[model samples]
Target: MDGRRSDTRERIRAVAMELFTERGYEKTSLREIAERLGVTKAALYYHFRTKEDIVASLSDDLRRGIDDIVSWADATPAGPERAQEILTRYGALLHGLGRDMVRFWHENQPAFRELGFGVGLRYQFRVLADLMTAPEHAPLAVFHARQALLALSWSISMMGDLPLDDDECYGAASAIASDILRRM
Candidate 1:
């Protein structure tokens, strides 16, 4: 797409996320998103047909990002060192996708479930967790691996109310996740 068109799509997504965060996915409408973006409903419609479409567009990007991570993990040998590296990489992926996208995903679980994004993300998490515990696939090891991943995700949603900023929260989660891996 052209630069202006891509920028419009991004602006729509960003405003939609803000409205979803403030008014909720179910409560927020296309008109509200358009008003927030200072665009007409027709213009917003040109980008996204519905609120679910907006969520799906963002979630699709996230799925592709996670898929890329999964592909990377699959190419590399599996071990604690690799798993730890995955956690670091996953943090970067989430941040690169934008905090608002992750936060909205956490907040609108029901909507995402309906849209199938939740299932896709959950599967991606399992694949990564299994990679963390690779070869053995031990239940306990997988448990710890999942916990480590959760630490990264929780940092996006749970830490929002905390006094810490994004970098601080991410640093704390990464440290805790690394420590969790050490236990396994």
Candidate 2:
């Protein structure tokens, strides 16, 4: 896509996320998103047919990041070192991707579930946890792995209103997640 077109799509997604955060997915509409972007509904439709399309576009980016991590983990040796690296990479991935999309995913889960985006994310989440507990894949080890990942996930999604900024939230979450892995 041309730079202008790509930029427009990103602007639409960013504004939609802001509205989705401020109002809510169910309460927010394409008309509102268009107004927020100062564009006509027709122009908005040229990029996205519906709010779900906006969300799916964002989700696709996140999924690709996770897929890249999974592919990297597959090549790396599995152990505490690999697990810690996964935690680090996962935290970075979530934070680097833009907190708006992750926050929207957390707040508008019902809409995501309805849109059929949640299943893939949940599956990939489990896969990451399993990757963290590679080789034997013990049940308890997997449990800790999942918890560690949740620290980073929740930090990105649920902690937006905290006094701390993104880097602080991520730093704290990464530390907590590292502790969780240490316990395993």
Candidate 3:
């Protein structure tokens, strides 16, 4: 029963993300999400009462995912090689979340800003980058660290029009990110 309930919640989130991306967050209503899910509004409300709730839940999940990555990086020895591994794991996580949510985020910066999710994630991103570079923390090193992470993040949303698969995209992004880290 617990697993079934969790599955329903995930279904609601996936549908909501699809609707939010296809129609824009501002134009999407909870009714539309429920309609798309073939569920009643009340049924949808059992898991998420509002569109904001849906987005907040997704943001929370994403934050937790990032936090896990940061925790893993923190436990490892800091070095260029470690930085490359970090980028690989980060790309894998974003890919697991699918390209639509990432594209929605890239296309809807205003909505993300309004929700305040962008600021926290951005800060955490910089902190993780700093951790990856450690000790030296030179401006140029930090710049490269950020560029490496940004390349992985952007690859998901930016290359949507291309015919390449997710694994291929991740591989290309990982290679570029590794190159950036190497330059640092």
| Per-model TM against the reference | 0.95, 0.96, 0.95
List model 1 lDDT by residue over 1-184, tens digit each.
6999999999998888888988899999899888988889999888899888888888888788888888998899988888888888888888677666778889889998888878878998999899888989999999999998898887777767778778787788888888888878
Return whichever of 2 and 3 wins on lDDT.
2
| CA lDDT scores, all candidates in order | 0.85, 0.91, 0.86
Candidate 3 residue-wise lDDT, 1-184, digit = tens: 9998899999999998898878999999988999999999999989988888888888887788889988888888888777777777778878888888888878889988998889998888898789778869999999999999999889888998999988898789888888888988
- What candidate 2 gets wrong by more than 4 Å, as runs, is none
lDDT of 1 at 6: 96
When sorted by lDDT, best at the front, the candidate numbers are: 2, 3, 1
**Which candidate's lDDT is highest?**
2
Clashing pairs in 1: none
Could you tell me which 10 consecutive residues in candidate 2 have the lowest summed lDDT? 96-105
RMSD each, Å = 1.2, 1.1, 1.2
* Model 1 vs truth, CA RMSD: 1.2
lDDT, model 2: 0.91
> Mind giving the per-residue lDDT tens digits that candidate 2 earns over 1-184?
5999999998998898889889999999999999999999999999999888888899998899999999999999999999999999999999887676778888888998999999999999999999999899999999999999998898878887888888888899999999999988
Q: Which pairs of residues collide in model 3?
A: none
